[model samples]
Target: MLVKIEGIVIRARSFGESNQVVQVYSEHLGKLSFVARGAKKTRSRFSALTQPFTIANFLCFSSGNGLPTLNQADLVHSHQAIRQDLLRTSYGAYWLDLVDHLFEEKEPNPGLYRFLKTAFDWLEQEKDPDILTRMVECKMMAAGGYRPILHACAQCGSEERRPVTFSIYQGGFLCETCKHTDSHAIPLSDATIRILPVLVNLPIDRLGEITIKEETKQQLERVIRSFLMEHVDIRLKSWDILEQMRKVWAASDDSTST
Candidate 1:
């Protein structure tokens, strides 16, 4: 039972001293794991193809029951540049971690695979990493059926003429009258409201073209973090590492500002 797959290396772990356990998000197989024999010990052929963020062509053998065993792997593109920069690497790991948490195993979703490929391409080209990361998160959330409501109120289905209250619990915006009654809703800006559709619908490659104010970007980032927490509901270990890095960057930013 030989299968060929095109996928991104979402995760890799050591299997003894000579092999590896890899998890990949494939176009045909959704999220799947493979055991690469001798991929670590002897500088084997599949060495380069097994790293995180490496897009690869894999040949595997399985009984369609459990984790597949890797027979061979051919490197496609490594997105090596993404690993060179600290910020890019952190964001990329965050993106892949989200993907790992959001997706189900062996449920084929070509749309997600393509979306991630585009995202990696953008990151590889040295584009705005944060905006691209947000864009991918937005699109991936939508694909997982947790799409955010921005244009109108999610509660009463009202399309009011002003900024509305976004409720993660209610799953969208609420009108002023409705928001007054609900204690959990948060205020949103019109700019953030208007851009939700574009973020969900546009291609990732063009994400850099979307101009947003710093305040609006903060709002959107908060919204996304809240949304993911509500839906995914798992603490990521990498998130803490990223937060430490963000604080370092924040201090640098503050110094520059002063």
Candidate 2:
């Protein structure tokens, strides 16, 4: 069966010598795999189209069961800016890894497809990639149906204004009284709780207008990390790579400043 799909190349790995296996999140097909027969060749037709962060339209010969064989690919958008920087590359890889690992195949979710496309666009242009990365993580969790309950206590459902606690396992913010229910709950500031919803609910383009403080960013980052790790329960190899890269960048910065 022949099929056409409009999607972004989330991942690309060499198959053998001249072939490449690509994972794409398409508007029509949520997550699909394609094998580009000669993608590794220097002058291959699909060479440019079969790359991470490249959005394209693909023509494939589908077996209707497993991996599809790529016949042709036409480029739609090349996120070149993201590829130019190491930090951006790592964050892009993390996004691709999360979608590839968590999203189920053949499930058509146009909302998520659009969200991811917007995220890549933002990643390519946005100066504050760290804050953008955190925002995307929150959006991903909500899109995946694990939306954190930030408005009220996750355990007791209290909406009164008071200090709250964050419970990754219990799944949201808990009021002071309900904090005892989750012994592991960590204190969450009123500001952090307020901005949690804003970060997730705000439109992507407007993200530039909002400024996130370093301390607040750290809090959100911790919450996001714990929430994803505890709830999804999956080990992300990309996270390790990002952490290592951060250390290297920090050391390089320190040396330059001295």
Candidate 3:
């Protein structure tokens, strides 16, 4: 059957000497892989449209069983700004990898598809990539049915406690009284605790209004990373590379400061 799909290219790779395989997360069709014949050549029309992070409308023939064959593509947004910068690309790649890993093929998730499209648009606009990334992570976790409890205690649902810590194993905030349930819960500052829900619930369009302290951002990163590792447990090559790049940059900064 011939269909028109609005999708964001999540991943693309060489299929043969001349063909390219592109995986896209569509608004109505979820994830679908398409074979673009002769897309490897510079003159091929599919070459640019098949690039990762591009949002496009695709015409394809679907057999409802095997890979679809891409017939034509109309560019919506190339998101070239994201591709031109290394840091942005790293963060964008991580988001794509996370989405690809969390979602199953052919399952429609319109909310996630819209969130991803908004994220790429914001990234291309030069919004703080870290903040955008954190928002995406929160949204992805929620979409995956593993949203951490940030509004109240995960163990007992108490909001009257004075101090709280995040527990990866328990899957959210633990009130002071319930903190004993997890001996290794990570203590968070008031700021970090306050921002957790905001990150999770805030609308993507209002991202510019959100400002986070460096310390709080660091703590948020740790908590989110631990939560994802404990629950999702998927290893992403792009995330690994981003970590390495951060370490190298930190080392360079330390050397220059000394």
Best prediction by lDDT:
3
lDDT of 1: 0.82
Model 3 CA RMSD to the hidden true structure, in angstroms = 1.7
Model 2 clash pairs are none
**CA lDDT of 105 in candidate 2?**
84
Residue 237 displacement in candidate 1 (angstroms):
1.9
Residue 85 C-alpha lDDT in model 2 = 82
> Which portions of model 2 miss their true places by more than 4 Å?
63-66
Instruction: Show where candidate 3 strays beyond 4 Å.
Output: 249-258
Using lDDT as the yardstick, the better of models 1 and 2 is 2
Candidate 1 positional error at 78, Å? 0.3
Q: What clash pairs does model 1 have?
A: none
Q: Write the per-residue lDDT of candidate 1 for residues 1-258, one digit (tens) a residue.
A: 999999999988998888899999999889999999888865688878888899999999998786789998888899889888787788889888988887788877898789889888888887766677678878778878788776777777777545477788877777876786568777878887777667778877677777888898788788777877887576787777777887888899999999
Q: What are the models' TM-scores?
A: 0.92, 0.94, 0.94
lDDT of prediction 3: 0.89
TM-score of model number 2: 0.94
> Which ranges of candidate 1 are over 4 A from the true structure?
63-66, 253-258
How many clashes show up in model 1? Answer: 0
Give the lDDT ranking, best first.
3, 2, 1
